[model samples]
Target chain A: MAEEAAVGCARPTGGPVGEENQNETLQSQETLKEERSMIKVGQKAPDFIAPGYHKGAFVNVKLSDYLGKWVLLCFYPGDFTFV
Target chain B: MSIDSMFVHKMWNDHELEHMVKGGIPYPMLSDAGGKVGTVYGVYDENAGVEARGRFIIDPDGVVQGYEVLTPPVGRNVNETFRQLQAFQLVRETKGGEATPSGWRPGKKTLKPGINLVGKVWKEWKTTDAFD
Candidate 1:
């Protein structure tokens, strides 16, 4: 647990998001809201890097890392909740 | 991805998911805490602090091609997602010259997109073929 925390600590929460919203992060919360509107098909997906469980281990899931492959971003409510 | 922590995902994969699959889910189950990723996708329920069940299919170019969001109690389907992925790959390979019919599966007949093909798909492909 401590090791995992140390590994994840290197990357700040929403690190990639903050990088993507460089200008907005520097501004007020309103700017962040304005910048992060709904993402529609035919538009580029907002890139993100989040902590994830994969292959029986913890890892950073970078959306860009899966480029060149078909990606299905399956989002469900919290696990163990019938999903 | 939902707002679940990595610890919860680990537990689920090891305890519950392993029973269904040989080694649980094959893909990465992301932990998007605080619904940050969900908010961008418009599936976040701020009050709930979790994402509604959603599936976004993205192509190789990182462009979202399809998505669906349903509340809990209505689980999503992996088969449907895989079918769409295959369809998308086929369409991409053909450069939109070919289209997959409803319930299309690999090795199934594909329709060529053109004015002549319009209203004539039935002549080439029957509704029953969707199952075959």
Candidate 2:
């Protein structure tokens, strides 16, 4: 819609452009924030017992195995060059 | 190249593994072959055949102390991860008595609220204050 385009252009940073836009933007942002807030701080992390290829062998790595150590569980979009 | 073949060989090839090791990637890069982990984490993009870039700082007790999930287009900052670790470390050292604000750095002033305290802590903060 032209109105949406105007709003998009007016707010290049994707924030609310006007009073009318504020309500819609806030709603949309809240939905997104909720979806992104899946994991919470100081909560028990989801455990997993999965096979990981380490040193050319399939090894079973479990969340419980790394107990008492800070674990940085990272998920990357694919392995190769596509970021 | 096909996704299956990419997963079979190129995903965890020696050269890539060596490069990651040399680059000082401390943690193991686990492959989410069947997208199960990614699916559970809500980062799996089925059409893309990959998970969205995300990071979780799990504490020693297996609890997720901090979590950050960025959109694919916006890459994560590695240094920020270290900063988060340091912040968490500081908080642990100080017990559950204090919390760091945005852009808070280690060895910097921390907030300790009292009954009489009002407004932002930084506004009345003094350089010579004991908490600083």
Instruction: Specify the highest-DockQ model's number.
Output: 1
DockQ of 2: 0.23
Model 2 TM-score is 0.67
Best-fitting candidate, measured by TM-score?
A: 1
Clashes of 2: 0
Q: TM-score per candidate, in order?
A: 0.76, 0.67
- The residue-level lDDT of candidate 1 at A26 comes to 67
**Cα lDDT tens digits for candidate 2, B61-98:** 88888878765656788888988898887777778567
For model 1, residues B24-62, the per-residue Cα lDDT tens digits are 889888898888789888887664566778889999999
Worst 10 residues of 2 chain B by lDDT: B1-10
After superposition, candidate 2 runs with Cα above 4 Å error: A1-37, A55-57, B1-13, B20-26, B123-132
- Among incorrect, acceptable, medium and high, the docking class of model 2 is incorrect
